[model samples]
Target: MTATATEASPTDSYHGFLESLEEADEYAAIDTALGLIDAGVPAERVLLDLIAPAQVEVGERWARNEWSVAQEHAATHISERVVAAVAARAVPRPTRGRVVVACMDGEWHALPPRLVAEVLRLRGWQVTFLGASVPAAHLVSYLHRHDAHAVALACALPMRLPHAHRMIEACRRSDVPVVVGGRGFGHDGRWAHRLGVAWAPDAPAAADLVADERALRRVRPAELSQLADDEYASLAKRRGELIDGALADLRARAPGVREYTTAQLDSTVSDLGHIVDFLAAAVYVDDGSLFIDFVRWLIGILASRGVPASAVGLTLGYYVDELRDFPRAARFLGEASASAAAGTGPRAG
Candidate 1:
């Protein structure tokens, strides 16, 4: 039976919506959203308050190990459907200039930006949502062809900030103003400032920023003078070699790894690469806290999966030793390693 929103409180509706996602019931989730709309709830509210928070919870559940990756994907897909249902029920005619929304290169999380796109549409802007992992050149070409008034770029992971910087510059070169948001920019958008791009905390802010041409284009000059040292560049070039060395070090230190399954080995390699990528981003932005925060996040993630925090500490130690010649990279690693050892790493936002 289809659920109705006859007397459902906002809290009840949100919980039920999450329940539907947990069950992978697309119809039920859509019904919950539509029901809210029928109950005089604004479609935009349903999109932001209802669908958006539910997706965030879905990610938290996966992070906590309470939900598997497959479960998270299913929940995200259902949320996408709910967003579509709400949009379909209340399609607004675009009354403003065209806005292009896209994910940075290598950023695969499209749902957050999709919410921004729908909200922009609700507010009467012509929004073009280019989904996940859009390459820089292709995006620039699209912007040139469309004559967009502004572009909103998203980066979900801090490790992708280097690529995000490149893409932001690419858009600016074409004379299209850029506004970026997401956890990648730091919860407070500090990293966005480092990259020298305008930022919005969420969809509504993005909409407001997009509508104002001056604010969107009033970004400060990028503070990447630290890149002059060539540390970030050298670290990126040695990515594969670093991962290999870390793996060899891990195998020697942890004999249990020698008997691990293929999946376990693959995950280890990915983690090592993540450490290097995130370190390079920190070096690029000249921030040690970025790497420290990532270490905290990595510790929690690995802890939830039964890996010890000491494993991360070991890896950081290895990187510090190997990159000792690169002053910036070495300092960042040393600081993070100390934090990880002292259990003082700041929580990821």
Candidate 2:
């Protein structure tokens, strides 16, 4: 029995799986779906029908900010449980194959690749999930040690694509297939073909392609680096638009300063302070002089009259403390700032 072989008594249906998301009973939905898979549902149906719909709900909820991280985590945990439960019951075929799944180094989103592994496992393939942010060297060493038949890489951030590309090349010398998937693929489906390797639009699509034996064996010629000039341009343009819109909104709200009230200003100041801290940590200073000026302006605004520098510094300290847990240089400054903000009110400059 090959990995791609069809089931004897397929249990789950497409419509039935779609309905489960509407039900929103995470555990029950996943558990029931796994029950069907355990009873011999087709691997394709399990992915396209059951898992995909549920994930769409999760993604939509996340986009609207309607769900907490804990809520999202709960859904994902349930889904993982379902996948593992079903996989446990899968009878491995005579020639069970192997796949390596990993997030590119510096990328933290793990659900995509983890789900992909579960899908492949259902098809009777073995999987090695390296989880998130694994360094390039470690991944290459693991590939050599495991001699995986295929590598599945996921990246949620476009900035990590270069690292992903590097990892793809690492697997090339071994003749192992690479499947790149996730939010980072961007607007161009052509980027997939251009990668000079197979790319799945999502987990289900990738599994379907791999399940087809003919598609698995063919290797296309390597085109120029997938990290092209235009791809970076697209990402940069989008990022700039977001920043511009945010700054414009801030300017619009600036005139109604009194409307902020005490609580509202507190909230606004708190959020802006955190954002500045986050940007400072994540963005590269060498990117350009504009970004450097922008950061400076941001700090100045938060510290300007009608806003308290202590509160700003204190909030910044909170974020810094998160990254550096012990012996923080900012602790004393943060304490002083908090004391000043409380004594004079956050409205004082």
Candidate 3:
């Protein structure tokens, strides 16, 4: 009476796989993926369909406050184990050139790029997956030492786009063509376009892009002339000062924050820094929507944790007044504040 992989819908397999992730049952998750492969499901499908979507849901669950950080970490660990297990079962010989895949500097979510690495391996490319948060200098040195045909980079957070750009430029300097992906580049990779690098929406596209040498190297010029304004640099230089000022403003405006526990205080500081970083990234790309979208997302994340949206509004107001001299940054802050007040910001998934 048991359903076979073919008999079971992809939806059923995904739900069962997600359940394994939820329970942190590494064995069950591995068995589920391996079972799909044994039942003639392509290994690529098992990776992109079963594992990829499940990992995304894990992130969404954490965002919605249904899962704690510990739970999410546990689930992610199990997923990584599952990926390793699946990869071990199907060792494909490389038939194509070497492609190096890595997370951008400061980008800690290695799983996404790992999946991409596995896919490239399956597609016959010898892929070296340099896991999370690789520094630019080290990555450049590695590329120089090894004969890398191309490099694929990942960034999961939009706030890291500026850093991602620097990393991409470093790879370019080493004469390695770069293909960038992940949510950090925006869902459609608009931010990657702004950085003037090649972009892929997912693993399959990346695999294809890396195979075509000419296409992989064909990148438009980076549209960062706005950096001439010096606002992003100025804001970045004052990041520490801005965070300290925001914390002081918060304590004065909301006395309850003054009594927060050490952990809460640490989280508050991180959030304050994220706001400034996202704002700076927006200015770097000259895109107001980047900052606006982050504001909406931050409001939702805070709300799920029982924090009020008005608190964010208050902080935005403070930033707007503080940065009035920086026309571009101040204008972006005003747009975010207005979006938050009008409740027009999209709901965070």
Candidate 4:
């Protein structure tokens, strides 16, 4: 950690450490974290209060293209290391029952779960920190073997909501209660409730929720009985075609997009998958706003990287044309396309 003034404010320390993250200065990041602990900050507080905020900024910087993917990954990797280092020195209190912490399938963001796992340990709960993207089946098998009191599943992206539903159901089949968290569940946990699971808005809440006897009661099975139609499923089945067609269209019309480096091209593919995935999830949850809010955020990301806002319109129009029969998708895509065409998509904060 970089040296700071004797009376530096929290804001100053936050921004200063964030710069160290952007610079990929592992020593500075680690040292700063250690120094905070030495200055009487609790290890869990350092992880949640300070380190977590810096990590969030890393993602925001990447989303805005203010930082490259490599920088984002490097910084995230260091943040994870810092969590482990802090946990290594912390003392666990009297033991509570065992719990399992894992990410939903297809969710590669493991840092959030890792933080929660460590926090649970510090709170005196024995935890199995099953890294990232654990299959639903694997989770059930573990429940059968270890007899965990509860499962804490983390999902960091809205696109993973569908999979979160799957994991939630699998846990129910094995009769294990699941407490779901992460931004994917929405700030108010609207999706988590719809998916029929306990929702934790943050790590501390998750720990508190885990300690609640009522939360561990097996909830009802997930019911997306909200949507009267199957538009989301239909689009998801044709997702491959959507991506292929979009790539071909980009190759034909978008200058430089077709000639992207391997990394750039892969990122484009991932971004497209995220778009399709989120739209499907939004529809699955029967919320048109999810897709629109996402579009606004995506536009800001693309704009920061010099991509034309109208590109969002082009891509969305393709979806509208393909799903012309799906009234729900068509309506949402149409509205979003208009927003893109008029260059009015919302910007990232």
Give the candidate number with the greatest lDDT. Answer: 3
Per-residue lDDT of model 1, residues 1-349, tens digit only: 2344445445668998899999999999999898888887778888888898999999989989999999999899888888888889998899999999899999999999999999999999998999999999999999889989889999999999999999999999999899999999999999999999999999999988988888887879999998987888889999999999999999999899899899999999999999999999999999988888899888888888898788899999999889989998898888788777876533749
Ranked by TM-score from best down, the candidates are 3, 1, 4, 2
The regions of model 3 sitting more than 4 angstroms off are 1-9, 343-349
Q: Pick the candidate with the highest TM-score.
A: 3
Ranking by lDDT: 3, 1, 4, 2
Q: How many backbone clashes does candidate 4 have?
A: 3
TM-scores for all candidates? 0.96, 0.56, 0.97, 0.91
After aligning candidate 1 to the native by TM-score, how far in Å is the CA of 166 from where it should be? 0.7
Model 2 segments beyond 4 Å from truth?
1-27, 38-40, 202-205, 208-349
For model 4, the superposed segments whose C-alpha errors exceed 4 Å read 1-12, 218-223, 226-228, 253-264, 345-349
TM-score, model 3 to reference: 0.97
Please report how far candidate 1 places residue 97 from its true position, in Å: 1.2
**lDDT, each prediction:** 0.90, 0.56, 0.90, 0.82
Give a tens-digit lDDT track for model 3, residues 1-349. Answer: 3456557444568988898888888898998999888876778888899899999999989988999999999999998998898899999999888899999888899999999999999999888999999999999999999999999999999999889999999999999999999988988889999999999999999999998899988889999999997989999999999999999999999999999999999999999999999999999999988899999998888888898888888889989989999988999999999977865534542
Cα shift from native, residue 130, model 1 (Å): 0.8
- Across 1-349, the per-residue lDDT of candidate 4 in tens digits comes to 3344344334446877888888888888888878777766667778887888888888887877788878999999999888878887786774888899999998899998898998899899988899998999888998999978899999878878887887888887887778999888887888888887898888999899899868557465566775556777787898998898887787787887867999889978877877788788888888777788788888877888888887877788877887789877778788778777777746432
